[model samples]
Target: MQADAYADIPLPIDPSALAALIGGTTAGVGILDTKLRYLYVNPALERLNGIPAAEHLGRTVADVLPEIDAREDMMLAVLSDGMSREITSSGRTPAATGADRRYWHGTYHRLEVAGQVVGVAGIVLEVMASDEEQRRLDRTRHHLSLLDAANTRIGTTLDMDTTCAELVDLVVPGLADFATVEVFPPDVAPTVRPAPPGVFRMRRAALTAVPGLLERFARFGVAGDYIDHQPGSAVPRCLASNQLVVENLTDDEQLGRVAHCPERVAVYRALGMHSAVFLPVSVRSGPIGVLGLVRAGGSPPFTAEDVVVARELAARAAVDLDHARRFTHEHTIALELQRSLLSEPRPPHPHIEVATRYLPADRQVLVGGDWFDVIPLRDGRHLKAMGDVMGHGVEAAVAMSHYRSLLRLLADEDLPPHRILEQLDRMVERSGLDRAATCLLAVVDRSGGMCQVSSAGHLPPVFIEPGAAGARLGDVPAGPPLGTGFGGYRTTEVRCAPGTVLFMYTDGLVERRGEDIDVSVGRLRELTLPADGSLERLLDTVLDRFGPGAEDDIAVMTSRARPAPGGCAKDLV
Candidate 1:
């Protein structure tokens, strides 16, 4: 039989009889003209659309039934091509009949008058399947979209709290009204033994809610708050068994069993919380945390499918957490080792007070081998040294220690700055060490009121005078970096005024990608220093302006020439 054979009746039938025949049926029948304007609708459609038949006539689907989201274009295509199409549409009813939401499976066909396509007709069947299946596929596409978005939303950073915050952000207002996450402290190692049958101490890493619920429950416990899970609570049970636990919070008796305290029970009731789910986050070693979610307001309780999706989200989060945990562990160990290797510089001489600072890259795991030292020599002279090894982490730090020790041995020989660098280069090359470094040496003669500075491919020293507009760059002869075996180094001498500040630093302080080194150097050259501030303040200003974007380690050292007492200079060194 043809799909629209019933519409081929010879003449219009009795309206009362047609209404009686289809009124009791569960299907909705409607007709429209070639322009896709509604012509007739039965009583069933009136109930389905919650609009009177008179209001539907001569109106497009976009008009009276705009909320249905029905594909009227497909129905119009059937009129022109004389083909049929079937689809399912889900939406809320019009405002007239309580505006209930529903889903309908609809079949549309061409309505023909003689041989000409005049209009289209439709038969819509309300999809009243078993309630479980209805909710499961409420819209399979919606569920899939959430899962797809989880990849980008979760695990954006290695930080533990950030990952948890991303997880809760994804589910709230879309999956539930309130979501929270609690995890063992990063210091706690994951173990196979189950938690004892009592309150387990855990850090609440993240807690969030939709605007409707945030103001009410955000005070009980917030992110970074520590709480103990009740004995045999869903969180501990879920962690122990690695299974999801779902509980209804609306039931008083059930709430008493699930909630740890009476105050919690009262809060749930006040919020109209209907249901909650606890999902365990685990890795290869064992369980580490739990993700908790609660639905309130008019939202329905979580279903079995929700459990599956929540578990998938938890699995992704657990992997990120595990990776972060391992990275943090390694970073901590390397930091401790570097600190142990690099001790503070020696005390400064009376004529020249010195200050030094070391800064590691903010975003990197390893601490690079950038170091500085102040060595007091005879005749009130101070030797200021700053250098940067080629690499990062433990090996680079160890190499830096060797370079500092070798320099101390050479300093006792009283060699000039360039001659000392020449010998150090030969020592490193003959030692067959693979690492390389850039170094700067400045010998300050306080009694003579002068400074002799040299550089081994390092940045120049900055000169700041008390009455000058800003700091000025000193002219220092550049030589090949250490370990290059380059013996060509020339020294430069500059007359220093009393109270002149000489600053030296590693390249990491100014070098950046796609920028000229001279431009970076000029920024330091134009900085104005406080006339009477402490050396600590001067160092702070320099680093604050230029240290934020450094991709490698940084070392900075400063020395100020002190005034001679009794207006008499000591015998020139």
Candidate 2:
């Protein structure tokens, strides 16, 4: 019986060595059958899984540890190839319940019995350094997403106030519990001298707060309110230093020092504010203003990462604000230049009562080249001219100046209405100027009792007679606009009764979008102007009737014929 070779044998095991190896190691060890069910789990594996060994047995990895799916395919491959492989996987897990997500570097080996693959065994070691690294990576990705959104939302228009509002919207309830943007007025001219420190002059351009705390901060300020920064306030200090000022609202002393007023401290406490940061907004020119961000309770205190994010946001907003500022500066300069060039029209002859009006288009529309002038010509005659260049903005305005000057020079030479326009057309063509304009010229002769009128593709002049029902559009032959060199202008002579009035204007006075020109001009003709009134009264009447469409610039010149000093009307027909 002793020699009968394998009567009975117990499973071989070095219990002491196995215990030492398993107890000394911190890695998790597990064995899975071909069905991917957990058959064996060491004590370390049980602890890592947050489940006891007894509970894990006979349970598939997908059933017991679903978060480890990152390595499920690798484990299957090891079973299929009967080989060993190593993988590093990361994710939330049952073992990490109530804890941060974790990463595990795992090595899987095929387990065989009797030359047939039976299962896969894996040893997993936690990689702790990746925890912080993953968090940093996540934050970086989030910041990038925010910046991308900002690109489309910010600086959508060349308007300073709108840009400020956009900046506030992007940060509210996202970067901070509440935020405010302040800036100098849009009209403030840039200067070499820095802004006075103690003056505390700033326009609250935009303000926003989280939904829960809106009412608490509403009393602080609103957009467009003029706010004064108290002396030694965080805003002015941060702007002066061109740095960020972070204040810890949780600390009483720190909050008091930064609060600058008793009211603000009370407000902060009421709102349960825990932290704040004042970031300076600066561009190439200089500091524009400051962006104030505050956080409330339940929100974590502002960290260094928050400061970095705020600084980046401020940088982007500053560039947009600077662009808007420069646009305003240029628009101002262009307006001034146009005004200077278009001073008061020279006094018309005393024989006639003349009145004129010029209205530039609204801000959204570009400034145009609309102009009107009353020139006193030789031989006691008066010249009335109204012209509009065919463009808008500074270039059109500059062209208008040139056109006005040239017309004056030609009129001073005592040329007739058509001749003056002919010379102007030649000069504009020969000068190689690319601009085109429409003009109307009228010469009122009191001694001759007739008025000569000419047009270069301009709107027809209206003649209103005393006791007439409606005004009459003059039948002057329309010619090509100036710069066309089409010198086919012909002046028309009309009866110049003492009580008659001649009204001249640009197209802007009557034109409307999606309407025919004839219809617009017809509307003006249908309005009855007061015949027995002063030139100013008649001009106002005409404007009232057709002044609705001011999208284009408008210029109106009205000249009324007056009897010369207690004499009857002269007839030279």
Candidate 3:
């Protein structure tokens, strides 16, 4: 049969073009009218919306996709600001299908045919491919690298703003060509202030002088300029009036470098940037500053990807900066107080081999008030007492100093171990330290194989006697803690044989997840110290095994019963 001749004309766009572009992957692609009607949709949209593409044509977005949160900030930004946006929506498409949670990269743009806004266009790509095994591995490695760097820098003496700026510097360049960390500082609404043209130029040198920022700035070849008011500058003065402050200033004929509302254009120009985006920066309470990124608008400025990365990084960096500043200030006070409170370690005696180790917790300047005394008594005895006063930070350390002073006074007076506890109890009650405080006091009499101990809300000392199998524990007396007004508490005498080991400590030593406090202490008594011959190594092991979380500071004292020719018998007062 002879084929009939047919004349063909090119349509504005191919009917199958979208399907061909999206392929069989079922990626959602759709077009919307000014009224948000479903103007067009591919098969993927059909699947996502849970309706046939043909059925949805010419329907309003609200009419078809009822679940969409139209008022969302990002959505509002796209509609009102004409800004492009990408959203990831997971769940079964509105079409008839089982509920399936999957991520999508939904790009929204104002559809313009001949220059006027008609409607919106959307393209949604399922996140399946991006979540592939290899990508997961790469993400894991990147996250680990970032955490490693962050961890190392966490406890350093870096200031907040400088640290944040450095962090931004680290992220930019490899990621993009421009990055900035802005601090809004408290109570100052940046949007309301008009930006001055020469403001940037005025503060450029001063800002560049900042410590960490300069080094990292060299790393990325980026620079910074601050906004400041200047005399007689000719610029469309909108920084005092406009909200959206900076735009790409690549064109020589572009508007004068100043925002009517923000007034920071000249600073942007000096900083070698054309396009800049800003986000609020905050420490714990108030807004500390603003974070921003910039690039020459003519030179491929920021993209959706850039915004995504910048926002995520900024959130974490804000926290990091806040912690750094607070930690430094708090640490300075804490360390000074801790040092002042602790007694200087005395030189070793002929019969005593004393070992003391103190390690501050990770990234914090805080040293707990865990104090141990190795006092030589009047009668050739060793009076050892380790105490933990309540909490961490400065207050606890202060209380520690007071307790040590009182104990020393009692020791100097040569009071009995029981009497010392009674006097301490009275002193604490009178000093108003009875609220939220606990202490342990144990007197070790080396000459007499016994530990005369009276405790105030403290763990009893652990005693170990040598045997064929191993060392075993002796008896102890547990009583109410100090500061609780446990009236006239008596110290009990516990026997210690030759080569017997006595260990006393505060609660910081026996803390662990899913373990009872008593059981944890008992475990320490059962386990012998490490053979490495370092008390710090032993304490570090205890700390490492327990994981992270500090209940109280640790105070540990180890001693052995003196093997004497006359006999191990002296007053442990």
- Residue ranges of candidate 3 with Cα displaced over 4 Å: 1-299, 303-320, 359-368, 434-436, 464-474, 532-536, 546-550, 560-573
Better of 1 and 3 by TM-score: 1
lDDT of each: 0.78, 0.79, 0.56
Per lDDT, what order, best first? 2, 1, 3
For 339-394, candidate 3 gives per-residue lDDT tens digits of: 76775556234555455655555444366777877776776665777777766778
Cα lDDT of model 2 by residue, 1-573, tens digit: 011122232112233554566644678877677877766667787777788776666668778777765568888999888778998887766667566778788899988766877778789877764566788788788777778888999898877778988998898877888999988766644343344566566778899999988887898868987676677777778877888898887766666756656467766787788888999889977888889999988988887887888898999999998988777676666677778888878566555676888776654466688888888878778788999999888899999999999998888899889999999999999998899999999987767767899999998988776677877888888899999998888898976666676788999998889989988887666645564567777778777777766678888887665566787645221
Error of 3 at 375 (Å): 2.0
Model 1 residue 62 distance off true place after TM-score fit, in angstroms: 35
Better of 2 and 3 by TM-score: 2
RMSD of each: 10.1, 10.3, 17.8
Clashing pairs in 1: none
lDDT of 2: 0.79
Expressed as tens digits, the lDDT of each residue in 215-251 for candidate 1 is: 8977667898767768777777788798888898768
lDDT (C-alpha) at residue 7 in model 3: 20
